[model samples]
Target: MNGVENNLDIKTYDIPTDSDPVHDNPIISNILLSRGIVDRKQADLGLASLSHYDTLPDIKKAVKIISLAIEHNKNILIIGDYDADGATSTSVAVMGLQRLGAKNVRWLIPARLTMGYGLNNNLLEQIYQKKPNLIITVDNGISATETCQTLSEEGIEVIITDHHLPPETLPNATAIVNPKLAENEFALSNLSGVGVMFYVLIALRAYLSEQKILTQKINLADLLSLVAIGTLADLVPMDKNNRILVHNGLLKIKNQQCPMGVLQICQIANINPADINSVDIGFKIAPNINAAGRIHQMDVAVECLISSNYETCNKKAHELKKLNNQRKITSSKMKDEAESQLIGIKKILNSHHDLFGICLYDESWHEGIIGIIAGKICEQMNLPVIIFTNSYDDNILRGSARSTHKINLKNMLDNFYQIHKDKILKYGGHAMAAGLSIKKDFLTEFSLLFNQECGKLLKNKSLKKEILTDGQLNPVNRNPIFVRNLQEVMPWGMGLAEPVFYDDFIVLSYKILQNKFTKMFIKDKNGSSTWNVIYFGGVIDTKKGDEITIVYKLSINNFYNKPDVQLIVQNYTLK
Candidate 1:
């Protein structure tokens, strides 16, 4: 591929000359077609209905079991995880059940620092105190086989609604509702934990309507706003099904039909709900909700989602904001320390040219922020990274792993477990991210073995970083209308990425903002027109009158209530 070298030693690939779809503006069509949206039919499919919800394995059974619980008025407790997905799933379950006329519904979430993950014996002891007649696990419980048995033995029927990969032996719950257990179709399998619970609620609503047990009309669309937030926050792949769900959910949020809590969160984040998009949810809103789980307790996030009182929701939103700010400071410190240690490790391994993975451990690192640190390091170095810190139990070190291109973190961990089963106590996650724990004494050995396996797996894979560009934007195409067309596409995330284009420009002037952000103005090669650009977390060392090549995404900046087109720089090469 033709490439341009950037100051960071990264290469930018030249835009491809692929066939494009027919649209009013060829620029938009080219961008869409480059992402595999070949025709109008495919574009329409992005907003298609989620018709495969009923085909999910065991969904009907789960609905039947939940309907019976509601009809019998049995006390039901929803067990949720501490992440955003878990918090939203808990809110969806509790609120949806109450709407279905269930009077004794309650919820519980495990504290990461104290209770750890999943429904274990310790959590079961706490659940026993509640003495509920039935238990519904959302976003978690797939791995809690013994916990399921304990609940069953206690005469509490268990309904498991999760999306995590199940183990060899399944839990003997009353009904297991998980998309991973269904056929491998994207629509059937890529549902997040909250997405799964939303489907269960859909089936339950239909069953209630069919059985003539409905006291009042319940529209499931009202809950799509929550599903959208949870789905975006979880970082799941945005397949057609997910895109549809998010598209519909965005409509609710844009129309101000979302819960008061969601509105409050948007307000605290300084994002106008009516103009929000997937990026806002992923960056601004999701972080605050996740912060409640990471720094404090997820109960604050759940309460923020389920509370109807505006004042209470606003108070919780502010609390989450505070926690998020604190989390940022902690994460920044951990990242600096990790980077420093990484430099030392590189010095030690200078003789090892085939190193493919990195493992770092420090008792001082906060367990709650290791994941974020690992992700940032992995992105910066383009290597698989596993960071460990002491768990509540000093004998074991809990770690979070993040992967780069062509590396499957889950598979790598599984292979490591196969060879050194005793070293790794437990591991679980998807291809790009995972979590595990190991004996503190085996850290050195485990690190060596992990790098060896990763090196073997990535021997032939390219490690060079490449910035892909859609194409050069024509002078006439750089306008607010183009930005509006981009927003019309609705949802964009994991699978369907936002568009980035590359072009050469003359640097007119630039100013530093907050010592971290760069605000600049650039003109076309002929200096006919200029565009405003903002680069976050990036520094430009070049001066005015210098020519440069930049890859950027089209964006809209609303200042003083007037929207103007702007470029958000991704990478740049000075000439």
Candidate 2:
């Protein structure tokens, strides 16, 4: 509101003048009050405050199946997806099963390039070759009805632990454990796949303890590091339950109680494990592990997560980092290509009048990176977006869709599937994001259908690119101490967003970094207070001596045990 419009809109929360909680830091108090949190005790992110695992529906059934398997030492196989959540879930299940007395436990993930999502025929055939007695699917299998049925008919007990929303017709597995199935029946509905798997392990431990079959005990907290990484990485709502898990897990990693690989990855990224925060997990650690899944096999990540050896974990960490480097390069190319396509779309925007959603595809785009591309474009466009690319099957294209609060992308895809049941190959996901496959020739038709469905969902709504901030920062608080204090206070994610402040500043100097980002030195307009700022988005239209309003989140640059406050620009208005 204070600078030139670059399609930027700013809204600020009304900070309380006098109702600050006396015990907490003032900055944290401001954030809490802004989120309507009056009682600090309500945000108890301690392990003891977690909701009881018994509240989840079908837990009894799932726990019984797993308990029976562990008692008999039956061959158990973990089927996981190819994401950070899936890797952590598989690691937790495999290690937890063995800890609980299961003798034979193994794990595998569906290769994104060779075997798309969920339990396809190829994945099923691969599973048959393993000849496991029971199969536990984590982060997937909620929508694999036919596969689950097929597995059931073959007498292989299947226990599905997922957090994704279920379809209209639920899968007929031996026991399906998903929070969405309960429809808010309990408070733990927002758990991630790894969280759900950890819950099963907790329930199994309880059952064993009750039945007097317990041999040795393990601190489930030992597994909390993996749970924390998976939960935060999944970008699920940072509800109190999840925050509790993360808070505990962060404690484990901070105290070096976690597996060697988790800490090694963090260190490799130059993050101090002792002072790690939410960003370290979401941005640095989790992404490296996810790289293996995106550019290579997630088995590399799972092995690291489940291992305790220092040297083995260190070697795996470097491999994951290498894969992440490759993914970043490929992703940048795909993103640039997608943006070029959008530029062309805008050229035809006048004829289209207004677009409610976006659908784009290119044969050159990598199938594994399409989801990230879709999410990035959705944020930039402020509308639901679906990105497609060549898939493993000839004549078929794989599409990943991301949606804003204006529309339910998953529901839209489900509707499209219902209407063109004969056209779609496969489809599944949650409310905000999902994936599907279709004939390459139907790309144009699918694009039109996607736009129509999104428009219908957003009947009278107009797209508005808005950023909410926590007012402006006081000059006195602009230092590394403030940044450190904010990071140490609480975790931030979907529900509790990281702190963002908007302020007007005059550019003292500017330079371009990596030929894309704009590195600037600016001083506050009112006060002479100055700090280094970096706009990682792109080159700006502003210049030296120009006064502009910018929204930014506070960051810290820690080098050799020394830290300095850094402003990472979110959006800026040029004057």
- Candidate 2 TM-score, true structure as reference: 0.93
Alpha-carbon shift of residue 202 in model 1 (angstroms): 1.3
- Taking the tens digit of each residue's C-alpha lDDT, what string does model 2 give over 1-575? 01234777799877666664823677668787776566677666777888899888899999888889888889999999899999999999988988888999988798878886766567888888889899999999888898888888988888889998787998888898899899654678889999999999999999999888995676777789999999999999888788888888888999998877888888777777888999888889888988898899998998888888988888888999999999999988998889888878868877555677898989988887899999888877778999999886769888899988768877777777888887898887778888888988888988877777777778776566778899888878878887877876667877878889999999999997767778899999998989889876667767789998889999888756678788899888876
lDDT computed for candidate 1? 0.84
**What would the per-residue lDDT of candidate 1 be over residues 218-264, giving only the tens digit for each residue?**
97686899999999888888876788888888888889897889999
| Model 1 misplaced regions, further than 4 Å | 1-23, 45-48, 349-355, 512-515, 525-528
Worst 10 contiguous positions by lDDT, candidate 1: 1-10
Q: Top model by lDDT, which number?
A: 2
Q: Please identify model 2 stretches exceeding 4 Å from their true place.
A: 1-5, 14-23, 348-356, 414-425, 448-462
Global Cα RMSD, each model: 3.2, 2.8
